[model samples]
Target: MSRITFEDLEALDDDDFTEDNSEPMDEEEQDRLFSHWQSVASTHQVSIPAEMAGPIQQMTRQSNAREPVPFATLSRHEKLDEVVYEERMYPAGKWACVTKGEELYEQSISMAFMKLMRYICKENSAGRYLGMTVPVLNEIQISKDGKSFVRDILTAYYLPAEFQQDPPEPLDPDIVIVQREPVRVVTRVFFGTTTEETISRQISSLWELLESTEDFLRDTYIVAVYENPGIPCRRNEIWFIRRDQ
Candidate 1:
């Protein structure tokens, strides 16, 4: 029989795998499979590459169960038969934000997330556990070429209501407290894992639905991810700040 390599496994479509039709593996079974793969690689004197290791890691990782920052739904309207966007009013609140400069949106957000996570996890001047919040907001500035992102990609975590009045100051210089003003945004929601390509497509779809109107700012937009990387069918959104507000 021909050896089924790691690349071969990666190349297989969802329908090609028997496990696709099977029930989701429990934690114990996931652990067993993880260990089994490690043992196989060890016995063969080979190492698992990152592409393969990532999915393996994700399979065993826990999802973020934090509460989302509160917002008031001002109104909702159907832009398309399949797409319903909303107008939301987010009250003035405090947010812990980090700015990262990287070409890739994923890479920049990943780095900034760690810093903001540390701030909430008690790496602050007050040494208080601030807890976590969902739908991390990433504000992206597209490059001049319009094909890639610029240096300043700001990632922010909304401070929970309890800490909105007096949030702990971050010890890390890169992490700053942003006092956001009450503003209204028109947002469109989508599902699945987010990437640069996916984000662009969503934004373009939103733009077309909005008819490239002057109602919202077009210079930059906000990308919000409500779930952690481990979660499947994750909720994501594209937010355009209304110019009238």
Candidate 2:
């Protein structure tokens, strides 16, 4: 029989000691922790301070319909075709809670959901908001007028979700601080006007604007809020971020 040397024994000891013993997170554990919080939020019914409710509702109404016409959008679709468009930036950071939409089918659904989250955060409160972190590219659908915007508001727009075999995008949850502000959008398609040409043009323009403005990214997108789609108007937001870097 071969005798093990001190070094060999030490190596064995180290291997035994270093094995990662961290338990995998099971669904039960996740639910146990999360359910408690759910109960809390549900019980507390954290109402937006009365002062902030009107703006939130108005902003929601606006997101559902009415954004300034983006003359610059016409020039966008004329540019890039299939790529994930461009990364856009806003002036300020906002806080958000990511929520999902009904009958979600793709990761884009979740992305749009988080995007809405950011918008909702801004609209809900009058004061600045510093919110969550963002991860990946979700889906996007273009719109032109109020009726379509309202449709998106009702339908919850494009769903932001992950694809099968795809990893969940990383987000900072409640880490980086941000200052919340309004957001805007512009599109060419409207409710009952889902023309390929119009949707294509408006979608192209929005991507272009995002590409142009990415330098101002506060950090990462907090979340995509779902707005029932079908309201209209070219949208854009005057925004700002107020977190100490």
Candidate 3:
């Protein structure tokens, strides 16, 4: 009887939608990621400086190929409408993560990626080298510009929440069997979005937009971000992988 706007459709009364996951925050992505970072920290030497995070993320933000753009210059959706995106958050590490896992062929790499990710997310939510994942079907290759790469891996069956206690899914047999590539060597953050689609076409659109630009997209360090339930996080961040200078 009443006209429901897009925003209205996007929003429903709290009473209308009860929380799906039972133990929302208790055993989710945060624990999994932080745990991994914690384990890796003992092996590394240098500690991340406190103030460097802001600048590091700023450096990673995608800018215009021709000229510099201000953060204030664009609206929020304008920034996120992209299929593939780059983001810089705290902890200073950067990444080029995506949303989908089904696009790639060899799902094993995805498993390895997840294993490495859980190690980080469970160990250090606040450390260098955050974990993130994006969906791509093409071979993950480093670019001539030396800033981007395209690799594909199949990641069968992803858990929407609570990864800390969850076992690694998508065993070798479960995957579609496409192609696999080692993750680029970079320090990164894993930000993901539940509202987003991780399928190949969507990822391709994201990839194409970046590919057209003078800036390169190679050795794309893909990280997967699982949003916290309580936080207003539906979509996630996908920053480019950092290259060693």
RMSD of each: 8.2, 22.0, 16.6
Candidate 3, residues 68-89, lDDT tens digits: the string is 1111111112345542344332
Winner by TM-score between candidate 3 and candidate 2:
3
Encode model 1's per-residue lDDT on 1-245: one tens digit a residue: 12344443334342211132225666676655455445334322333443343344332232333567888998887635654788898888888899987656666776677577567666787786565677799998777777766767899999887888888888889998999888788899998645678888988888887755888876778998875443334589999898867
The TM-score between candidate 2 and the true structure equals 0.21
Q: lDDT by residue for model 2 over 1-245, one digit each (tens)? A: 12323233323322222222334435664443333223222222221223433223333323323221111221223334543222233332222333333332222232344354454344322332222222211223323442221112111221122111222222434222223343332222222222223444444454454544543333221222222211111122212222322
* Model 3 whole-model lDDT (C-alpha atoms): 0.30
Q: What is the C-alpha lDDT of each candidate?
A: 0.68, 0.29, 0.30
TM-score comparison, 1 vs 2, better candidate: 1
Worst 10 residues of 3 by lDDT: 62-71
Can you tell me which runs of candidate 1 are displaced by over 4 Å? Answer: 1-65, 79-83, 144-147
Q: Candidate 2: where are CA atoms >4 Å away?
A: 1-56, 60-102, 105-126, 129-245
Candidate 3 accuracy as TM-score: 0.27
Ten-residue region with minimum lDDT total, candidate 1: 13-22
What is the lDDT for 244 in model 1?
Answer: 66
Best by lDDT: 1
